[model samples]
Target: MEITSKLLNSANAIIEAKIDAKSIENKLNDIAKITAKKVKIDGFRPGNVPVKIVLDRYKDDLLKDAKQELFKKAIDDGLKDIDKKTDEILGEPIFSKFDEKDGNIDAQIEISFRPAVDVSGYEEVIPEYSTPRVTKKEIEEKINELLKMIAPLEKIEKDVLESGDFAKFDFEGFVDGEAFEGGKAENYILEIGSKQFIPGFEDGMIGLKVGEEKDIKVKFPADYQAPNLADKDAVFKVKLHEIQAKNIAEKLDEETLKKLVPNEEDITIEKFEERIKTQIKEDKFQKLLNEDLKPKFVDAIVEKINFDLPNVIVEQEIDLQFRNAWDSFSKEDMEKFRADKDALTNKREEYRSDAQKSVKLTFIIDELAKVRKIEVSDNEILQTVYFEAYRYGIDPKKHLEDYKNQGILPAVKMALIEEKLFNDIFKKDKKEEKGE
Candidate 1:
């Protein structure tokens, strides 16, 4: 038996091993001896089968077990020679080469480990900013939105359709002097300014009275989804049926406040205002995290921090991303992939840069999590899963089981940790900026 190890990179290493014929025979005999004690052959009583008979009868199965044992032993011996620990290894070891020749086996296994990262001055990259504050006007606007949401739509006693009013009308569009498919509808409810139809179609309805018929001229945009109608002029024959508007209250009332926040007990105008204020504040904070601060922070860290990622993990990420986006591939591209194996590789290269960045961010977040002492326990994860399940009307246990079966529980936990870590960092930074 011979084993040697080589460092491929800081985060990856390879081990080459060769097992002689005598060593393979010894391993097979050792396994056979163990199997003989538990054997139940027809010609022999249980626990009384000869080792020679056991080796001959289950040669293939025994040889497989022997090879596995030898492989593990080789890894152990190689790790010892390289002064590396088992727990330091990351993911499964990939077998780069495994071949048997002349009753001897040669194997080369590649192993990876988490790269070392120095996140000492990571906070320097975080931009200084004032804490986001919600205003009274914003709170009032949110309250008005809630009122509009709960208000009932009532028929407006008016002759003409107007902007901001709901118009229920019948319309049939024509192209090149002929009616087209999906170009006719009866009693279609559209908000005048909603722009649900092609340009000039909704605007053409303005000032038109109930039972009034008019041919509204419009043109479909060049990039319209339907190529047949793209960049083409069309006339929609329209007849306004009715006009409706939400009967929202100008002032806050007890009934409306109760409707605005159904979960609140003993709701009042003042309490509802406070609730809306808090909600607006929280929403602003979330927007800051999601749209503004988080992206900037991630970009800064990824640019500032440098480390070599394990190649296996990067490949895994690329594969996962490709699988996730498989549905979005064009039919022709999918067919190409099916017809040619290399076509898949060519397509996967498009995601390589993004995958590398994603994998790098993952490791960076991992290191930052440790630096900040951020952790999500199993209970916290389960609680989150249960909350999500209830939100989506799914059974909690089944949701959790699906996550486990799909092998994404760790990814979910990491996401939670990353969110928590970012929130903590941003909050602390805000405090520091405010001289708190």
Candidate 2:
């Protein structure tokens, strides 16, 4: 066998392998002999079939099988040679061109090679780490939100309904003076300024007195998801029946505080407030850390690295991103997405670039992990598995098995390693800061 490789692009290679006809013929002859011993022929016992008759009956089939086997062997041998020369095999080989004219066989195959990246100075590219500070005002705001969650609503007798006030009304909506489906309701309670109904609806209810009937006209927005309602005008004949006011409770009392903490006998409003503040502060700190770290890390890594990615890997990443996007879109949005094929295609290409960046980043992270000798122990992995299961409300054993089968265990390990890397880098920087 003889093999030659041509560089098609930075990420693609074309390999052409030529196998000896004599070797192929010998394999075909061996197959024919094996078949003659087992295969039955009319008027002749199994092993007694004539060689000429066996050749006549199974020559084509044997040759085809032999060619496939030889092609695989040639490709494997060629790839082995390439790997020996370059020390890596990145993606699946794409086979093309099989010639069998006049008993002479020649085949051509194409394989994609992973690009080697020279990654360094990722720390310089990523931003410096700074801990986020939680303020007193933010803590107060969170407490207020908690109070509103426990607030109650109260009924009010009023002469006129106003914005921010809940109004109970009986209404029938008409499109062009004709009633439409889902256009009428009795005793419907709506907040006048909530904008929950069609445009101009709540505004028309303002200043409406109980028992007063009025026709409210409104137009649907042009980009409304409902096809029948888009840009359509409708009139709702509303009769205001009642008005209600939102009632907010005062600060947590002994009873309310007890209800919030049934298990803890020593619970107090001040303790609860401090707990809320602490939780809020942790959440804000994590969010700020991610926002500051991710872009800087990617930019730094990309700046230091220069290499082409295998097309197979990029395409695979593109498919994963497309599936993720499709899963996140609503069914209605998906229909609109299918209708706009060009837009979706553009989105796929954009995701391809993101996939490339992700691949490049993975390479850099892996390199860093190797240099730092980062490792995750079995005990640590078990702890992580249990924590993740509890967080997601799943059984630990079942979730761990599922993660293993789905091949996500490595990803979890990588995440753990990356966290360690970040901590180490941050500590080193802190030491330098202290020294300065």
Candidate lDDT values, in order: 0.87, 0.76
lDDT per residue for candidate 1 within 1-436, as digits (tens), equals: 9999988878888999999989988999999999999989998988899998998899899999998999898988888877888898888888889899999988889888889988878989997766777688888888788788788888899978888999888989899899999999998888889888788988898999988999999989999999999999999899888999999999778877777778878878887787787677667777888898899998999999998888778878889899999999899999999999898889888899999899899999998999899999999999998999999999999999999999979988998999899888887433543563
- Cα lDDT of model 2 by residue, 343-388, tens digit: 7787678787789888777767777777778777877878999998
State the number of backbone clashes in model 1.
Answer: 0
Give the residue spans of candidate 1 off by over 4 A: 153-245, 262-268, 330-350, 428-436
lDDT of 1 at 182: 95
lDDT score for candidate 2 against the true structure = 0.76
TM-score for each candidate, following the candidate numbering: 0.76, 0.62
lDDT of 1 at 323: 98
Best by TM-score: 1
Predicted structure 2, TM vs. truth: 0.62
